[model samples]
Target: MSIYTIIDADTHVTETPDLWTSRAPAHMRDSVPRVITDSRGTHRWVLAGGRNLASAGMTATAGRGTFKNPPKTYEEMHPGAYDAKARLKYMDQMGIWAMVMYPNVGGFGAQQFLKLNDPELMLTCVQIYNDWQTEWASADSRRLIPITSIPFWDVAAAVTEVRRCAAIGHKGILFTGEPQYYGLPLLGDKHWSPLWEAAVELDLPISFHIGSGDMAEGLVKERVATYGKMAAFTELAVDIFLRNGLQLNDLLMSGVLARFPKIKFVSVESGIGWIPFVLEAMDYQFKGNSVAEEHPEFDRLPSEYFARNVYACYWFEQTAPRRLIDKIGVDNILFETDFPHPTSLYGDEVHARIKGGLSDCEESVRRKILWGNAQKLYKVTGPSADDEAKL
Candidate 1:
């Protein structure tokens, strides 16, 4: 039986080689995503146009030592990364009651689909991934919450998929922080209004994960090349942190939150420390700048909307909980493990790390950060009363 009622807000699932191929229709099978070995013997996923997506090594890193030496093949990775049954065993050992799982090769928000010129293929890929995710989560539906992705290039299609996935028990939708990179409308653009409305009406939170958009690719590559593997990893982490902050600012300033009051936005894998500063800066800018004056659509300060609708997750952060908890608000802060990623809080250490981070807070605040907030945000009722008591 587990001791902690924990919910991981930003874990990942390394898709198996056949995740898309097996589910694709006969006519589309040839064009669906499949694995191919490069000349160097590295396993990389190849998309429709023979565009090579990232390798599995980049996604499956749990139990492996150091970012400098990630697993180079599917055979070297922990089974929990792609196998739900194996994941539940690991979850039991870690005492995590539930986890919100994102994609790996699918580019977090499945943004890689945008690279496909065939819109029909792209939409089919999205459906296949979501169907596979649903099947994986079925291994233990109460504990594994699958987040679905959509074709952001088409807002109407996105809305349809959002509704479809929600009807099948998906808790949230994973989307790119910046859709403008794909020549699609930005989050604040009117084209996204229907999607946002569908999400709001469906009671599904729209989650924005760092690196899900195109903004970080160049910087990540540059950092990795300039610095060695470990240093490059550190630089990427910092870069993602800053990018999430910018995304938050964009959504806030865009007046989307103000417009859709009930819709929630989660900044996944983005720590909580910077949130206070962003909120403060947003309020300051709203008061001091003419942007707010020119756009009177904002009913209140950006911070107000953030406090009400925005959420941030922290996996390995300690200082944020200690120093900025009150400013960030316990309700606005959640917890994550980033499981199976290079920098995850995996194995027995996860409990110790999370407990140590929350040691300074009141028990109530700790409970909220650990599971209470997630329960409310994701609408997780947990296992049945009998099942929970047994655990």
Candidate 2:
């Protein structure tokens, strides 16, 4: 009889070594990324930044996982890694009633398959990854909301993929935010329209999660070129805002929101503070006739459309009760624990931290931040009267 109502809006699970290989059709199964020992005597996936895939505690390999390697044991890297029972037990212990789980490896990693430039191959790879992820979430549907990943290279194919994913019971879609992938900028491209339409038609939210897919290449390239550890992560986080702020503004100003009123967009891992600043700057610029003149598609104020459609994750550093509620509105902001990310704060301290920041607000507002807001965003319904009464 658990009474806590916390909903972790974002969390992830590493793909098992057999993820694509096991679920993929015979012809494509062998194409999934394979793990091999590197020059450092560590195991790493051929595709990932080469952080050892086996060292993160997510793998059982003797070498262990690294950012350069996958975990040696899925359980160790992911904590609850592959076991549903362990995951549920941890959720119970931590007072987390539900979570929206994204894939660890197969997510934007599916983009790697796209880079192969074979549509048939990309589609097959995506299907297998989705199948495996769906099975993983079936372990506990009540607690885990699985977000589907789609390959965005071909618009028609992407539309077909979205419908298939929705049919398979996905709550949302995960996409990469990078502009140039293998030497191509996705900005202002018409190829993404159909998939955007499908998401709008299906009334599903599209979540742009951070990682290789959507991360800015400029910073990553700088880090790789310079070999400066401190500068790498710092530049990376800043680059997220610079890149995504434009993308979000583009979606709003391009009449994507107006054309598809049902589509909702969430920018995860990008933090919430940027929302206010971006919206304000856009609105200010719109008044100058520059944004409107350059992009004639926009008719209404850009900020209004954004407020109606966009949502961002709240980080500990960005949690300012009054200013946040005032600038972004309580309903538009949601909280997340970067769970298992080393910096994640997911225990009783969460209650204290949230309480401290939100103490000035009424209990209703606090409860909204704690539970109701996420339900509204995720469209999760509480138990029926009979179900609640049983408790």
Predicted structure with the largest TM-score when compared to the true one: 1
Residue pairs clashing, model 1: none
Candidate 1, position 64, lDDT: 61
Candidate 1: list runs displaced more than 4 Å.
39-41, 48-50, 216-225, 290-292, 385-391
Give the alpha carbon lDDT tens digit for every residue of 63-129 in model 2: 2333334454444454565566666777766666677777655443345565445678778777777
Could you give candidate 1's per-residue lDDT for residues 27-97 as a string of tens digits? 88988889987887877899876787877777888896446667777888888988898898888677788
Q: 260 in model 2: Cα distance from truth in Å? A: 1.8
Question: Candidate 2: misplaced stretches above 4 Å?
Answer: 37-43, 47-72, 107-109, 178-190, 212-227, 290-299, 383-391
User: CA lDDT of each candidate?
Assistant: 0.84, 0.65
